[model samples]
Target: MTEDLEALRSAPVLETERLLLRPFTAEELDAVAAGEAVAHFAHGFPSAEDMDFARESLMAGGYFFTESVYARLAVVEKSTGEVVGTAGFVGPPIDDELEIVGSLAAGRRNRGYAQEAVTALRGVAFRDPAVTGIRASVPEDNAPAEQVLVAAGFVRRGTPGLETEYFLPRPA
Candidate 1:
């Protein structure tokens, strides 16, 4: 278990055709976790809940480690080198399953960034042999996120209510 945790803490950066998924710097994670403004972000976080989520994720990742698989990573636009969003597991996997969460900057939405980021994160999560599947829960009315998850190959797993659950099993 210690070796597994160490490996997770040293996970590599992930990249897609158009985005770079890099771990958040300690300072950046600290700021977001504290609900403080991040200098490089064009627009600040969308809401307090976003900051809360960031904090929770940082805690789950273990503060002071930048490469933990549960760490919230900056979703950078490769061409512009801009941080357009964040992606990460909600926490470490349990029973070979984990939940993924992501958010795009307000101005960066509707651009397919969420789908790209989520897909990249899924790859990262599955690289660990322990991970067998991933899941996501989005508000029932969040059609955009639902579409992004669907495009990333997540299928609805249960009845919809205030929130809908989606799951994606690792490829054979």
Candidate 2:
């Protein structure tokens, strides 16, 4: 993934009225991977050994970057510029399709940041001629996030209990 890392390191910064999405450096993200910082995406702390595996993978840059995915944006706060979360398409699983995924600071939910941030990322995704739609999988219990996705135009598509999927078409 050396090529993906270099491309991610070179992509342009994305901006919104209240957020800045950009390529995350190891310095910007080590805390999240190291378990030193609190994260809202995972259900619980991983075992220490799991954290170590993740730390090494992140430091080596095995993950796909935005440009490589050609759509995902690393969510950052406008004021602190600290990465508060991740928002964007699935980085590597597919390229022509963008699977929207996001998580905000636990204290920051219900404030419409997810919608605002997703809206901005949508702008980026639609700019690519090859991308025609975006999708997000939200748990059935996550009524708030479901609302945000609908407000952003995603509609329920499928899935069992914890895996319901919603999809929204890319704007012309």
Candidate 3:
């Protein structure tokens, strides 16, 4: 599906009660993918696994505002101006649906940052009109992620266990 690259490029900065969600610049994405420390981050950068994921996602060429519903945003804490995590759509919408992806820094978890980030992303997705809903898949062992999704109003939609899928419909 062809996407409006300009729209993606012009993606807005989203603000929540305690967070700011800003799209990642190509350079920043590259830096993260290379496992280098990003400037202005109080906490350390994303994990090596996350960097690998970012690299693979970038190489796939449809995430990060080129031709997909991507928004590789950095989740920043409003108070300290620290980058606390990463959050956004996994890729372009498929069948008008997309998956929400997020990861808080190891030290930033359990403080409700993930839920706030996901909630803000949901607002951004629904604003587009093309997005009908958002989904998230979490490993069964990842209870924290499940709680985050649940707090954000995502309900489990299928068989529960090892890998569970959750869905949240766009509000009318």
Candidate 4:
């Protein structure tokens, strides 16, 4: 895990017109998990919920730092040069499929930032060629998240339990 943390320093970055989906440095991930402020994070960025999620993911296996399409990239607003959220794959491809997750600071929502970030992530995943499909799931009532995935070209799959699933296959 320590080596993974060191490797995270050089993780690839994906950019969009208005956002940069950059991987979090180990230091930034540490700060977020500890609920401490990172210099480049926007006000209210990495909300309490985000902090908890980071901590949980870190303890699980540090997969976010793996040298693969799986990563927890910070979603930075290019104009402000501040991190407004995070978007990334849940882990390396499983059976040639990967799952993605994203979240934004309260103030950043509804601005199409999430859509842009997810689109960037989707492009990165497909670039690997080994990835055949990408998936994301939103809570049943989270219309905005569902819309973001749809806008990124993810098709509605089905409701599996309390969450609705969306999937985007590699471009033909």
Candidate 5:
């Protein structure tokens, strides 16, 4: 685990071929929680659920400011420089296992963006030697989301129910 909590607060900016996963600034998180429009947010971005998550994360001292590898990162589309969604660790590692959550704008789904972001997150989580595994849960009916996890090398860990749990162990 990184000994410096402050260093972890500033998450490294992760870039994929088409997406940029950068930590959300305090100002942006505040604006999101208040339902105010952020300039770079894409249309229909930050849905009610997203807003609630942002508010809750901020209320918990800003997820990024905690000991997690990364906080809530705005998933930006490179071509337009617009935030199409958000993704990050749910909280700091527990038993060397961390949970992650991510979502894209409704209009931007099914273009490989979710998988790309999840893969990047997996990369970040594994970078910390203390993180032995990562996990995610998707509603059973959300086949697309499940597919994204699978594409990112996460395997289903239990029987499907209201939500299906997935896990990815640190690479050898």
Candidate 6:
């Protein structure tokens, strides 16, 4: 609910079995904010124009904080402490329901880091009294992402057709 950038500034790194997620940097924020990283997704990357638009609407609004502020931490390899990619939520709408963590980086896909990252992030998310559920939206054709979420305890709760929705509660 709070959009204070200071709230996320200097946030502690979140640890996982094989990864560490630290707050996103201004450079990384600019890259994502500028749509430079969209080519990595199965879904069409956000265009520079789109990112420019979002810069004002989403970035400026601190949405990445909850709705779209750049509150993400870099996802890194635990053993090497090398950055593998990023993990965290992207929208305020999700915060009001389930804390939705966007998936991991393209290079890091299939490494099971996504699963491990979410597993850890969910623990942190659920620690808050308002959090009740956690959810993710994997493209219908993204088998790897679906596998990661399913393996992490998210089960289908909607129609099996396109855009199917799956959900899981925060660990009690």
Worst 10 residues of 5 by lDDT: 63-72
Per-residue lDDT over 1-172 for candidate 2, one digit per residue giving the tens place of the 0 to 100 score: 7965564434447788778777555543455467665442233333353344446547556455434444344566677555566666555325466787777666556767798887877776666567778888887788888899889889899776777899878665
Candidate 3, residue 172: Cα displacement in angstroms equals 3.9
**Model 5 misplaced stretches (Cα beyond 4 Å):** 1-9, 63-68, 159-161
Single out the weakest 10-residue window by summed lDDT for candidate 6: 38-47
How do the residues 57-162 of candidate 6 rate in per-residue lDDT, one tens digit apiece?
4446544552232344556677755555656654333554554545444545677778888787776556555667877766588787777778889987766557
What RMSD value applies to candidate 1? 3.0
Give the higher-lDDT candidate: 1 or 6: 1
Q: How well does model 5 score by local distance difference test?
A: 0.81
Model 1, span 15-76: residue lDDT tens: 88888888877777677778676666647553465577667656666552346677667777
Best by the lDDT measure: 5
Estimate, for each residue in 1-172, the C-alpha lDDT of model 5 and write its tens digit.
Answer: 4756545545768899999988777777787788777888888788786788788877778745323455768889999998898888877788999899988889889899988888888888877778999999888889998888888888999864699999999988
What are the lDDT scores of the predictions, listed in order?
Answer: 0.77, 0.64, 0.76, 0.79, 0.81, 0.58
* Over 4 Å off, model 2: 1-12, 38-60, 66-73, 92-95
TM-score of each: 0.83, 0.73, 0.83, 0.85, 0.88, 0.67
Against the correct fold, how does model 5 do in TM-score?
Answer: 0.88
Candidate whose TM-score is highest? 5
Cα error, candidate 5, residue 15 (Å): 0.8
Question: For model 4, what is the alpha-carbon lDDT of residue 87?
Answer: 82
Report the Cα lDDT for residue 21, model 2. 71
Order the candidates by lDDT, highest first — what do you get? 5, 4, 1, 3, 2, 6
Q: Could you tell me the lDDT of residue 85 within candidate 1?
A: 72
Query: Could you give the C-alpha RMSD of every candidate to the true structure, in order shown?
Result: 3.0, 5.6, 3.4, 4.4, 2.5, 5.7
Off by over 4 Å in 4: 1-10, 60-63
